[model samples]
Target: MSTFYDCLLTGTFVFPLLGSLVLALSYGRLSERASATVGVASIGLAALCTLWVGFAFVDQGKAAQTLTLWHWISVGDFQPTVGLMLDGLSMTMLGVITGVGFFIHLFAAWYMRGEEGITRFFCHMNLFVFSMILLVLGDNLLLLYFGWEGVGLCSYLLIGYYYRTPANGWAAFKAFVITRTGDVFLAIGMFLLFTQLGSLNIQTLLARAPEWWSDGGLMPQLTALMLLGGAVGKSAQLPLQTWLADAMAGPTPVSALIHAATMVTAGVYLIARMNGIFLMAPDVLLLVGIVGAVTLVIAGFAALAQTDIKRVLAYSTMSQIGYMFLALGIGAFDAAIFHLMIHAFFKALLFLSAGSVIVCTHHEQDMRKLGGLWKKLPLTYAGFVVGGAALAALPLVTAGFYSKDAILVSALVSGHDVLMLAGLLGALLTSVYTMRLILGTFHGAPKSDHAREAEAGKGLVHGLPLIVLIVMSTAIGAQIHPPLDEVLPPSVHGEGFGVDLVEGVAMIVAVGGVLFALWLFTRQRGLVRRAVADPRGARLWQFWHNAWGFDALYDWLFVRPYRELVRVNRGDWINTICNVAPWLARLSHDGLRRTQTGRLRHYAFSMVLGSTLLLLFLLVG
Candidate 1:
């Protein structure tokens, strides 16, 4: 029998590429349903192949597995192979990418059912799945980069899927520009790694990293920081996070797939994959932790003030990724990955449920105008509760309790007292805002006419993913310790009861946050409204709501300054440089024009003068 690993090595990557080709050849001949079916099946097959490979690797007790198909590029001493590397880290990422990805493709089939460019939508989706697989499976930095840039291209296409909307197009452009800035640093880091280590292979890099560290090389720290820069931009951490809130302008499924499950988590995966490098540079890891902690708190506060349904979820996603980064920074790599996995489940559930809400509500996202939806869409409300519980890290009710609490515990035990406190506060804020979102959107009186007519749809398409995710979310926390430790390295600190403590405290904080939210939004509505409307209260709300104006500061410091420099330099240096060729052409033309007089006398005189000048110069010399 051919095992799943065999199929993964041969089938997963090829299936999507082949399916995409088949769809392209079929082109407009195929109906929308047929095209959507083909796209979904391709990714479905890829997911199966990923699962198979995961089981095979786990069964064989292999820490890492690599399969090389062909030599992609070779120049002098440089060589990069197109290959797949499956490890604990990449395997987890593969599962999320393919599994959640397949579901999103399914959801899109229905979401984009009547849209004009259905075929193009499927095409972009298949390409996205292919790029994500390559990203997770690549054995070297260069191949990974190919997948990285591929996903970026797909993101640009999908975010502007409705290119007619100038806002959507601008949002897509913003995502592209911001992420590309991070990519520049990532590229430089890869170049440095290759120059210093002479290899981009993951195993080889890890094996040689210690030697460089012992020799007092700066490459390790510099490379790690550069990679963090890329992660920050991609994951929407702190300073680079503003674009994600705006990215909700894209299709909801795009938001669920790229922002939630796959693309944003790429940064967390990169950090975990290169944990050995970070381990060698403890200072860099500390910086990662600090930045992550700050992002978590700031984004949590931002989520608290959002009225748009998707933007609220977007901020929550940012805040959640910050927790993963916090774990990574504190040397809790496994915890970070654990939280990432659990986050994929709930975040996808939340986004999809939100999509269904938006679909039924006729695209109205403002919570102020959305109320009393629990009766209209009970299943969606149920999904939201389950997902929100997970988001709040509410004890044993969901997967978040296990993964997120473990992170807080790890922080506390690692003696990062400040980080631990910040994480707890973030957790509280998460509970508050998420519950606020639920109560405001689902539990109150119908604030808008749309909700009065809102009706729940069949649960098969939308509810199935939520159900699957809920089960995974519930089961993930219990599966954390001994089983995970077999593949993952032990926690930085020796094992302790941090998990138990975290769970208990998480329950208390989550309930408190929920109670606080109810008090603020439901019980004390007039006060809340007054606070939002008053200048003093509005100022504080606006500050938190605008992500503490990090975006504005980045614009002033980075975006505005760069644009100004371009304008000034364009007017001065570039204008002069651009004019130089034309100026030279005109000079040559003028010199030649002197010889082009329409008179034989002038021509002869010019020739004699030239000869005399040549002779005089020669004689003088």
Candidate 2:
């Protein structure tokens, strides 16, 4: 018999899946309240189980624990089991997924009150949590891939939850198709890893990789690059990043839980989990850092151009993931995970708080039209400022400062001075965009009736989550420990942190970014408007507004070519074979129809003649 602890670790993923099944099977029969109850209870129980295992793991100081659930797949020499592992890395992710996840569910219960398709919404949300849990806890790479795509599938469903809107469905498809582009690369990489290593079992691979594979091998570099493709798609890194901003069509909870807090962070976790493999390929590691640096700066520029509140948050998510990627590039796996934790808190808080404001304003999302809401929606204002400050990494008292600073410090001292400069520029943007979001929406005078009506629709469920995440955003960093570098490799972290010239420079840049945002977006809003109205300025505005024309580029390059090919082929080569049988049948039937034109006498004559012919042919043969 298995102990509760073993089941508990696995249950953190399974229970939500079970809840999803229940909601799906009983769809439409349950009321909104009932669906919310089941959804909250399912994740709530998962959170409790996480707490249990966390305490035990800490108290006992266990190295790692693997629960063999059952045999999953077998084919002669290839066998992968259904199992769950609890180590420092996975344990931390579990705490984040279940703990922060539970609050998101709670907030959703209230945020989506009386909305249509509530059951369907919760079902997809619960399933997303399950998939994310599987992603973090799975014992093997194949199973992790299952979890990885599961989150992608759930994201599509949730984003298209409001199918009445044509834009929503398009957004969902965009997210699905773009991410799948990366998945193809991941599948190929997995095939190569299995072929070379002879196993996808993570533990075995991690343990035996160094012995079996030489350093600086082409195969390893190729595999790392492919896996990086998968990470880029899921985490919204550059080139594959245009999908996330449009994904704002989903519910606020979906945006918070999937796009911001949990799912988008999967790329960082994947790289961190496979830290051993990446360490062997120095070139690949450097590439990861460069991609992260460029993405952070690009995404920050995109966020600065956004007008919709959620789109700003979406771009913010991409930028933050870039920071985590930079940390991975610098070989600071622990710092990556640390920033991931803090980012989750503040980003989720920001999204949930945005949802509350949206609910009061009757779903208006344009920040230009939303202003002076801080006075009416005090709780939401407080939550937004707290979360934004964390995002900005305000000198002290914010969680983002501790975690993001750790990454900045690591980058500075890692002998890659150029990347350190890139890191500083990105941090400045982070602070700038965060302040832009606050001042444009909350600091200016009320521009519309909706902005003035921000305080009416408030609930305890909504307030509870905002308060919890606000507290987390402010304090979670001070308490964050380094990720499990003991199990993972090439963390490149040093002991004891202190302030120095580099740190001083980073803080000054962050503060300057914040001050500039206030001056340009708040006090000098008119001047900013006049600048944007000019032809050159407007061109830049439109450029960033459309995500650097990536969508248009993909449409022209990929979508149009495939569509034109389909049109040109018309029936295609396979369809030629399909046409032959139909044409032959039509010819035979036409001849037969001419003979059957008259009557019963003609049919009788034909049958007699056919019998005579059959006898003659059989005898001759």
Candidate 3:
């Protein structure tokens, strides 16, 4: 017998999965409208299922439950189960994955209406949801890794959906290969945990982790660092952080899904879910904060130099994820996940609206070539503003402010003043880049004749999800009480002036950054344009524009060396030896050719010589 919650939990991932199967099976059989309807309906059902399960879980007192389905593997004393788990953490992740995922799917339905192979696009997107659900719901590390690898595969496929372009394929491969490095680390960490403690069951692992290893033990630190490696790759943290920006070659919907709701969030979820293990390695945890803080600053400035609209959002995504990492590092687990949720809304909103703008402007993404779109697409413009405000963490109004303030305060409380200051600086940079993004497209004079007024009848469908996201982004902070409070670390302070002062300073810095961007890019464009055109500013521009030359550095270091090795071993040295064996046989046959040149004479002479030798031996004997 199963509870109603069980049914809903199973159906959450299943609904979209079934939808994906339907799309994949029908292939060319279904009409565009039918495919779109199925695509949207399937995800909508999944979202509904998530809502129902979440309600039941909450109503039942949010008591964590691990529902095991069956024995997954057995090797005499070692077995892991395959099942779903529900708690504050998984539920929050579920809501965001399916909820925001639903809207993104719907938005894509409209955004990708006219394209050939639209069914395939929806199919991949649905599959992504299913994979992500499995990831968040799985009750054990192995199952989570299954979902982990699943999304990576789907990401590669979706990112390279436009397979005609070589660049798209390359981008997809780059994402796949780079993230695989992190996966290797994750696998090693999993192996380490299992061999050390003999169980990977989430409850068992979490329960026994601290007992099995001392806080400063070598094995615990190594395991924690290895897991961090995987998280860094998946979440696109520093060093492994370069792949995410290039992932913008994907469709706007794919970008939104990958950046906002699914792939990037997995890393944050990983650390938060395994907080016990991390707590054993405080230095590693502190390193997490450092990585996050550094990445946020890097990404913020990188966003400033981006020319492509999606790239700006792409870098912004990296920077935001960095904030989550910082939070996790400082033991602000709940705040990290909380920010993860709010970021999903606002970031998805921005990407979706960016899609609308791109579609209306005839696929124009370069902001310098885009201008005066606020009047052209007022709804999209409004959604962009909402998302931008949240992204910029605009004081008390936006959701980002609420969540980000939590992180900054947590940093300070955790005795990470340097990290706290870095975060504030990143927030300021966030404000600047976000304003630059908004004004560059909406305020400047029309840069191209392609920009035109959007038709409500046709364009309104695309804006549907944007509106929902806008509302969520603006209002979600109000309801962020116990739902977000349960899974994270306890607050470092009660309601006090200290919290208020931190909030106030964050607000002022945020506002200052936005004002500065507005002044420079709009009112003072004439004055600053010349400076940017000057040698020093030009150098700065190139540095940020090229993502601080990380890509070039990687190419020179890893890519070129690998390519050179491939060239050197192009024939495969082992295979070359095999090639020589055949060549020698041919050479020996050629050497024997002369012996057989005159067949009759050669044969007769050989026989006579053999007979004569035999006779001589017989006579001597």
Q: How accurate locally, in lDDT, is each candidate?
A: 0.83, 0.87, 0.88
RMSD of each: 6.0, 3.7, 6.4
- Find the candidate with the highest TM-score and give its number: 2
Q: How far in Å is the alpha carbon of 451 misplaced in model 1?
A: 1.5
Each candidate structure's TM-score, on Cα atoms with residue i matched to residue i, is 0.90, 0.92, 0.91
Q: Which ten residues in a row have the lowest lDDT in candidate 2?
A: 490-499
Ranking by TM-score: 2, 3, 1
13-126, model 2: which lDDT tens digit per residue? 888999999999995799999999989999999999999989888776756888888989889988998888889899889988998899999999988988998999889989
Cα deviation at 329, candidate 2, in Å, is 0.9
lDDT of 3 by residue, 1-621 (tens): 147678878889988899999999995688888888888899899899888877777777888877877899988988777889888889889999998998998888788878888889888889999999999899889999999999999999999999899999999999999999999999999999999988887778877888888997898899999999999999999989998988988889999999989999999999988888998999899899899999999999999999898999999999999999999888888888889989998999999989888888888888888888887688889988999999999977788888899899988777788998999999999999999999988876888776544333254557679888898888564365536555556656435686678788999999999999888888888887887899999999989999899999999999999999988887897979889989999999998786786678879998999999999999999
> Model 2: residues >4 Å from true position, as ranges?
493-499, 579-621
